[model samples]
Target: MREAAEPRRVARVILLDPEDRILLLHGHEPDDPTTTWWFTPGGGLEGEESREEAALRELAEETGITEVELGPVLWRRYCSFPFAGRRWDQDEWYYLARTTQTATAPAGLTELEQRSVAGLRWWTSAELSAARETVYPDRLAELLQRLLDEGPPSVPLVLAPEIV
Candidate 1:
């Protein structure tokens, strides 16, 4: 009998800017619970592809930013949980990226439900305090606060730029 393959590692960028704004995306898929809510922009790493390449692809796909700057990842982690008697697999990767020039709305997305997420808004640290409930109840808010207080982190903030 053949053994099942192990889940590969993946990395994503939880992009932020000097303005204290973190890029949040709202994917409007019915099957996706966080569709309506805001979460940092990022996705999975492809086979044998560099983390930097995957980060660029995922960021472009989700946020429609063709231009980005990739900085050293701010966070790295491995998370696993099961649902409905099946293993839910995800190796989340988070990088802290920022854009050099102003950003434009995503031109078009392949996903159907994610289309309605045109409501891109920038939230400051203070604003996050008020809208804390809108995000996942994890260390995200706390991390943001720490980043804000300390300013340009001693660690590199993942920075990415859009290129055609």
Candidate 2:
């Protein structure tokens, strides 16, 4: 049997506007620009930080939007993907946050992000559902629709594993 790799715990934010559009960051591998995907704003927790703490900190760092209230965990997923030059096995927790500020100034990106991130955009659920380009978490459009209709689930929903 193959041994499973240890998963890195990452906190991610599902940032939504009052109009219910979701925010996503567009990124590509530094060495392979053609390989691109849209993902939420978040990163691995540092030290012994709580998931909420990491989510809030990553939100501010990645988008320059702060002073927003964060809601409960909305979703969870285990994913493995190749990024930069290494393969990552990640266990990700998704938190819901709302923001009126849409302008993003990614001033706090680490060197890796600076090299990999292409841009950020706001996406409506319809757009996401119809998009042909790659987006992380696979079923984001359906997930957002459910969240909009029912709010956060009592327990975070476990998403399908994404391997890419």
Query: Taking the tens digit of each residue's C-alpha lDDT, what string does model 1 give over 1-164?
Result: 99866654666666666576777665343454553566666555768788788888777776677666676666554545442344535555566677753474655444543544645556676777677455532456777887668744666433331111
Candidate 2 residue 163 C-alpha distance from true site, Å: 1.7
What local distance difference test score does each model get? 0.60, 0.91
Residue pairs that clash (backbone atoms under 3 angstroms), model 2? none
The all-Cα superposition gives candidate 1 an RMSD in Å to the true structure of 7.0
The digit string of per-residue lDDT tens for model 2 on 80-129 reads 98887789999999999998988888888998888889989999988998
TM-score, structure 1 vs. true:
0.69
Q: What TM-score goes with each of the models?
A: 0.69, 0.94
Q: In candidate 2, residue 9 scores what lDDT?
A: 97
Give the distance in Å from residue 96's predicted Cα in candidate 2 to where it truly belongs. 0.6
Off by over 4 Å in 2: 1-5
What value does the lDDT take at residue 158 in candidate 1?
Answer: 35
